[model samples]
Target: MSRKEQIEKTATALFKSKGFSATSMRDLANALGIEAASIYSHIKSKEEILQRVCFNMAREFFEAIDAVEAKEGNATDRLKRAIAAHVNVLTQNTEASAVFLHEWRHLSEPMHGTYLSLRDKYEARFREIIRSGMNNGEFTVPDEKFAALTILSSLNWIHTWYKPEGKMTPAEIAHNLTEMLLNGLTSSKQALHDTYSHLNTP
Candidate 1:
């Protein structure tokens, strides 16, 4: 990895474990087996490292949503894919996920605004999918934002409790989450039929 990548990797772990304020330049330098001042060669300050870590996580989050959005399918399928991709990336990248979930609030005003803007953009992807599903008569949610938030909240919480090596594989977890979210948001006959078939089977 490049020096900047190494710095981000190390900083992500430290920030997740120690939080932004509790972690220091000396801590990162010590962890990387370099002098405190050597870190300055790669990054201007500790805040820069935090910014990179946050940006890295944001990039991953948006990329996952983009991948799902680019898929060829109905809005429901796209939403399912998006939820699965979100969980897969967050669970597989624990440090980045943690940095995203817990450390984003530490960014300065300008940086925080930038982060929030990207976050809103990414979230709009989900809301758009939900709205499309509703307009097509595939979903029956009363509030689009609340429904989208419901799905996002469920998927976002995977970073907190999901384990890559746990009993369920990523595909299984994703399917369960997609099913959970879709069921709550949509009351279409097709969805009810699928649920009935699954629930009544031997």
Candidate 2:
């Protein structure tokens, strides 16, 4: 990697482990074995790296979701793809994903506002999938908003404990999670009970 890429990569790691507030440019430089001032040549400020990591990861989510949404399927299948896409994005780069999911709060104004806008927009897209399912009689949530938030909440929390070297691969986690979440949202109570009971099996 080039010097700039190296700096950004290291910054992502620091942001994940130390958080944006605690990680300093000097600390980043020390991690690279360079003088503090030298990093200024490639980075204007630490928040610049924050913007890059958060926005880039956001782009990955958009790209994955866009492709899944455009495919031929019912809302149920589309949501399955959306969940898989989300899990893939989180698992592919846990460090950057951790920083993206957790550290964007430290961003400055304008960028922070922009990130919030993008965040709401992204959540809205996910909600739309749930709404679509409700309209098509595939999902039976009383409140799509609450259901979407709950589903995304559970999915987003995966990053905190997910380990690539753990027993479950990304696809397995995605499939199992989709099964559990879908079981909850399905319109048929009998099917929901059967699927959920099976999901709880060892």
Estimate every model's Cα lDDT from 0 to 1: 0.83, 0.91
lDDT of 1: 0.83
Instruction: Give candidate 2's TM-score.
Output: 0.91
Q: Relative to the unseen true structure, what is the C-alpha lDDT of residue 133 in candidate 2, on a scale of 0 to 100? A: 88
For candidate 1, the 10 contiguous residues with the lowest summed lDDT are 184-193
Candidate 1, 104-124: lDDT as tens digits: 898998999999998888878
Cα lDDT, model 1, residue 92: 80
Cα-based TM-score, every candidate = 0.86, 0.91
Which consecutive 10 residues in model 2 have the weakest lDDT in total? Answer: 185-194
Model 2 alpha-carbon drift over 4 Å, by segment: 187-202
Q: How many residue pairs clash in each candidate?
A: 0, 0
Query: Which candidate leads the pack in lDDT?
Result: 2
Screening candidate 1 with a backbone cut-off below 3 angstroms (N, C-alpha, C), the clashing residue pairs are: none
